[model samples]
Target: MSKDYLSVMPEDFSDFGLSQPILKAIDQSGYTEPTPIQTQMIPSVMEGRDVIGQAQTGTGKTAAFALPLLNGLRQKKKASPQILVLAPTRELALQVADSFKKYGTYINNLKVLAIYGGEEYSGQLRQLSKGVNIVVGTPGRVMDHIRRGSLKLDTIQSFILDEADEMLKMGFLEDVEWILEQAPQQKQIALFSATMPSSIRRIAATHLHDPVEITIRSKTATASTINQKFLITNGMNAKKEALGRILEVSETDGVLTFVRTKMQTVELAEFLTELGYQAAPLNGDIPQNQRLRTVEQLKSGKIDILVATDVAARGLDVERVSHVINFDIPFDTESYIHRIGRTGRAGRTGEAILLLAPREKSMLKSIERASRRKIEMMHMPSVNEVNKKRIEAYKSRITKTLTEDCSFFDDLIRDYCSETEASVEQVAAALAKLVQGNSPMLLEEKKYERREKRERKQPVGGRNNRRSSGRSDEGMERYRIAVGESHGVKPGNIVGAIANEVDMDSEYIGRISIYDEYSTVDLPAGMPRQLMKVLHNARINGRMMKLSREGEKSSGSERFGNRKNGGKPRRSNPKTSRKPRTASAV
Candidate 1:
């Protein structure tokens, strides 16, 4: 095949020979053109042949397989599943299931059920008992149903392993193989992975019968439709503030913010909500139904932003998503591609903003090489810019109110003005005040109260000065550590260990005061649970240094002193032993 063949995008879905019902469904879906993967793989899948499709996450692989499979399915309820699709995560499973249902909307008697962990199984078992033409699930949950005799694959006509490489990365390859082995030998198997690693290729060779290979290689690394830009982070805690500012100034219809961890997803979402953005969290730990509801909210513009982990946002296809902000930079190139893929989908132009710390700047170069495109350096919207935008929005709202026919409100306004003997402008101003509520129309710039922490002066003294002047200031959180001066631990020990272990800059770490049996260190608040766990188990001076937030008695260090103290005990005892402190907060 010519190189151009791999990049061929069809003008329409009609050439794929889809049934009228499925074609109508596609037209209703607002998709006028077939993506490269769909254009190449649809016909092969319809021919009842095993196919191996290699394409990136947003290349329309779901429809590539789903359309053909739906078209070929006989419109009748069956006792056994006709098609089984194994996705690595619950989000992806639900996504694939939705796709199947959408394409088969016009086809009668087509029941698609999504089964995954973290959800009650009774409903799924009931659905399976009634008969589902298609079953989309994670491997472990699918295996559970299989073992329980609820899902029988003996009559399955086809098996699909979506994101096979992701399954391998998630350590689901074994479960996937076991599920594949259990399927009837007569069934055709189709495997789609972004990258065909040796392990995935081995599985294909073992299970598929002369599989037709289809690869959709994009002509460009990054999608041309997406405007990719990067913003240098102020510090570890500034992502939320920067994101808020960006949203304030940018024309975002809907946003998908990618964080590194599940806990961070919730943290960022809550933070955004506190900042007056309609945001919600999407993660693996959230119940499947709630997650779906959150996605629906984002789709309907009820939620303007969705803070999500990389895994949770997989296969999330929301058309209104106009911006993707990498609140946490992805660790790899492929993840970057998949994350930005959430936007700029189906040929729509979208914006992708990446927040990068100074240390993470190298990853930008790596990603640039991998994507074969330059990520333009972007200056975050200034506080002044945000204020201007907010004021403009307020003015626009007032202007819109003028254009609106307010006969209904006019009576109330006239009555209120007459009763109060007020002027028209006064009534209008009062109404605007009520409409604005507590929301601020302008933002103030607080230099020290930003994402980047200001450099603090190093505490002067030896370990014995631990009780001296190390005190927690406002905006800083104190954490207790089990390893202290009694264990020959110095201030340098705590700073070095935390900075190295947590991948944090020393400048961000605040005051460190070592006590006899424990120590207190001031740090940023709202740390993710994963990082806290890692820090809790951190070892120093050959001792397990248990770290926990100051107020929380998780570490049983409250007896030592108030956690808010920099290092000074609120009430000092001469009998309390201490060592010489060196290298206080850097």
Candidate 2:
């Protein structure tokens, strides 16, 4: 039977009958009350019953499972993976393993290892030989270890699947099934997914035994202290320009900017440095120790801006990160939530600004629904506004100098005035010119005014007086890709890959529809063969999508863009404003 929870939560972890050790760790984490997911999930897992959770990302699901699992852990002398956690990505595997280690810190004789494909196998092999109570890994690497006889599942007491639906979408359903069969001796199975698709449901039915299902239906809203906002920016140049102006006008001590790719982190950081902001780039390629040092610098105010990707910025908690700027729109609401979460710490108000083009505006609604808050439209910071801010700061500097003991400078200036017979005002004006250097005290407004005029004249939904791929689209034409719903592809993956490969703004892309065997996308109605070749070779979900015109042979020559149900378009990725499906958030 299925169970759902929408009631008042307990105020403390002690109410869940947790062990003293687990309770102590919870207290150290500064969590005074249990989240909705933790409140609903802890009791079931403590009862040793299988659980299936329907939660969206950012609902505190990790702690929900980790706390209960740690509370019941019985450290054995010969640890051979008493509990197994299968994740979709190596990054998640590491995160989950870290949580396990943290929560179980008070327990004696506890060991955890995160195994994935890219890392060296010798290290993993050494860990396994040393004996670990918990083994968290990706499906492929786990399967490899199982085949190599390094990982044995007969001793596993519980098996957990984190983000089961994501694994299915990433084409890991078969691998997950194989892992499940290998652990038939496991006592209970815990499956967590954002949504309950038919495939996931089938696996739950086949694997779990009389499970207690829990769903946290509460509105997953962002922190009320954050002022969520968005800017309608088109081309890359426009985004960079807007960023500089916001940085100048915003009341921020430190800013964290997120981008989609590592290359963008470097490029945007360099651009910000050129515009007179102390900025640095952070990505996964950077060593772990260096990443920590960079975060430390941000906290100490040595650098005011840090350009980073999602993975690099994970678990970053800095009280001074007052602003989070999304230089590029995130493909999913979960990522949007994670990005903004870096700020709004230590009871201070935070600001999250999303930069969106005309085409990417559709994602705005998804982010709002997931966050359960309205992101008000933010006016582009005008040149006049920037000038006013600079003038204030300049005057403050002058006031500070006047308060200091300037006796020697005053005497020297008096001597100069007497020698030249110039008035004190004239001498002060010359000194002010020296302080200002060659640059004007106020920002020039002519270029900004001309750009505003051009923006006002541009047509709706077109790039703001800028072409995306160095060419303007006359109109849109429908095209088909070899990937489809069967391949577990989403529209954002299609849009992200296309926009990145061609260096074009997402605003040029049009409506998309996913079908059973193939998908349809609307692109610029063009006759360029070279660009077509580049797109044709683009891969999605590790499969080369043979992108071709609609009604092509590779598309099965069937025009099903309009389905039998009233000839309407069906976009399946973005969820409705009511119930969100992602549950990977902390």
User: In order, what lDDT does every prediction score?
Assistant: 0.80, 0.77
lDDT of 2 at 404: 98
Over 168-260, each residue of candidate 2 has an lDDT whose tens digit, in order, gives 656788899989998865578899987787999999989999998888654442367678999998666778889998999988889999887
- Write down the lDDT that model 2 would get: 0.77
Runs in model 2 lying further than 4 Å from the true structure: 223-225, 253-256, 278-322, 332-349, 369-372, 391-441, 455-545, 548-586
Error of 1 at 252 (Å): 1.4
Residue 119 of model 1, lDDT score: 87
Error of 1 at 396 (Å): 1.3
* Model 1, span 1-586: residue lDDT tens: 2112445577899988889999999999999888777777888889898999877877788998999998888655354688999998888898899999999999887889999998898889889999989999999999999999999998799899999978876778889889988989998788998888799989999999988888766623237889999998644455666787888889989999988777788888888899878999998888878988999999888999999888889888899999999987775677788899888877889999998766457678877886778889988687788888888998887789889898988898889888999998988887778887887566657863452345223221112233434555423467888877668888788889998887665655666776767878876545555567778888999877778877566644344443455545434454773444423574
Give per-model CA RMSD: 7.5, 10.7
